[model samples]
Target: MSDSRVNLGKQHPAAYKALIALSAEVEEAAVTAGLDPLLVELLRMRTSQINGCAFCLRMHTRDALKKGENPDRIAVLPAWEETGCFSETDRAALRLTEAVTRVPDGHVPDTEYDAAAAVLTADQISAVAWPATVMNAFNRVAITSPYPVGG
Candidate 1:
């Protein structure tokens, strides 16, 4: 399909605004919780990838790169479990991000939660969760709305 076919900006202004506002709130929470901006973007990209949210994947991949994330790491994110590109903290955050993003599978298994909790402080978890929740919400919105992908 042409890029204009998936252009969310032209298709639903009100819905887009609401999603933007929600994203802003989540970003504020992430900042307050001391989550690394790059990490947050990475998590968003990963979650978006899992949900097939092309718009988000495109947007966040650019954002992550602009924020100094290593392109090689981003390229290998989907295979993070098998790669050594991520740090311990990044691994924890990614695990939590996946769990929260795909909660219907089991609401984040104890092992995953424990591993993330062991590396991140309470505040960090809160911050990370907020972004993950917000991204998931937006993912649904984009998916259900059938939001346009480009242009």
Candidate 2:
């Protein structure tokens, strides 16, 4: 164990609380946007995967499976752009999630936003962006804190 490490969520209870609240709002937005719940989890999982957040990867992968996401899709998610396994809606959302998660790459290329806008309703586009934003925040929290994963 690193003696210098702190659980960011535990150490900053109010910030974590705010994130928890934002998470609920994000979920509500996703549900109201008519995104499939499995798609929601997949977004979270894929974002976590990009962030190298093992804890969230485990948590969201479990959530995805519980929501009846195809195990094959989960396995191939890292290569989503090349796979025909995902629906067009899934492809759009996944692309948006990846772009949002990797904002350091280009501050979210306009092409990415345009691709999502082309396929998703305005509300759904907003919905997808929020969760990806929130997940990126959570990924930073988890990765910086070096949160433990697995049993």
Candidate 3:
């Protein structure tokens, strides 16, 4: 066995392009549904964090910061529940993103769904899921392809 792998996106350009298109559509949907662009980036960061996708975590973290997200919020994101840094809507979106990313844990249990529904409108809920879903796919691509990360 050798330490070598194909870059999935390069090997399968069509599928990768489709995923990118889906990501664009999801971005539009999130904006139309009234999700703050920063919040959307946070959701992406959270999903990447959970999935251990360093590539995405770096990308979305920079995106969030460039959009004026607080550095403290990003630093405290993994322990969000223990902090008062997040708003109710931020908390709801984070929880929902966690559930979607960790679906294998309990299959997006009603508890998580209910928690999100409590703070999010129907469109907002749908909007949040799209990012998480798309991030998960991207994470898989990056992790399996093992996209290189560097300082």
Candidate 4:
């Protein structure tokens, strides 16, 4: 960790641009799917938390609060199942996010997908999955670079 790492985004500007564009498109799709802005931010923060991405967690946590996400919800995200603060839709998305983010531990299972599908429409499912998918990629990029947080 003592050695500085290359900024993959800067080293390959085109790839970073592509990822940015993809994220924009995915975000628009998620919005079009009628995801609550706060919910989306919550999912983003939760995925980042599971990935141990400090940068993402800090950024998304701030964004969530700005968008009116509950502080208690944010605080208890890791134990979401133990709380009744979230809706069925939110729970499904969180579950799906965990499944997608933890793919190395176990391939995303059909049961998880089915559970999400049960509570979410097709587009909503895609909307949730895409962010989790992209966030995983972005998490790796930031973690590899060990992006600094705070001013």
lDDT of 2 by residue, 67-120 (tens): 788999999999988888999899999999988888888888999989989999
Error of 3 at 30 (Å): 0.6
Candidate 1, clashing residue pairs?
A: 6-148, 6-149, 7-148
lDDT by residue for model 4 over 1-151, one digit each (tens)? 4367888888898998898899888889999998887888888888889989999899988988887888999999989999999999999999999999999988899999999999999999999999999888888888888488876
Q: How close is candidate 1 to the true structure, as a TM-score?
A: 0.84
Q: How many backbone clashes does candidate 1 have?
A: 3
Q: For model 2, what is the alpha-carbon lDDT of residue 111?
A: 96
Off by over 4 Å in 3: 1-3
Could you tell me every candidate's TM-score relative to the true structure? 0.84, 0.95, 0.96, 0.94
Q: How would you encode candidate 1's per-residue C-alpha lDDT over 1-151 as one tens digit per residue? A: 4443454544777877887898888888778877778889998999999899997788899999999999999999999989999888889889999998888897889998898999998988878887888888778766765456776
Instruction: Please give the TM-score that candidate 3 achieves against the real structure.
Output: 0.96
In candidate 4, list every pair of residues with a backbone clash.
none
Most lDDT-accurate candidate? 3
lDDT value for model 1: 0.84
Question: Better model by TM-score, 1 or 2?
Answer: 2
Model 4 residue 91 CA deviation in Å: 0.3
Candidate 4 segments whose C-alpha is farther than 4 A from its true place: none
Cα lDDT for residue 140, model 2? 88
Q: Compute the lDDT for candidate 3.
A: 0.94
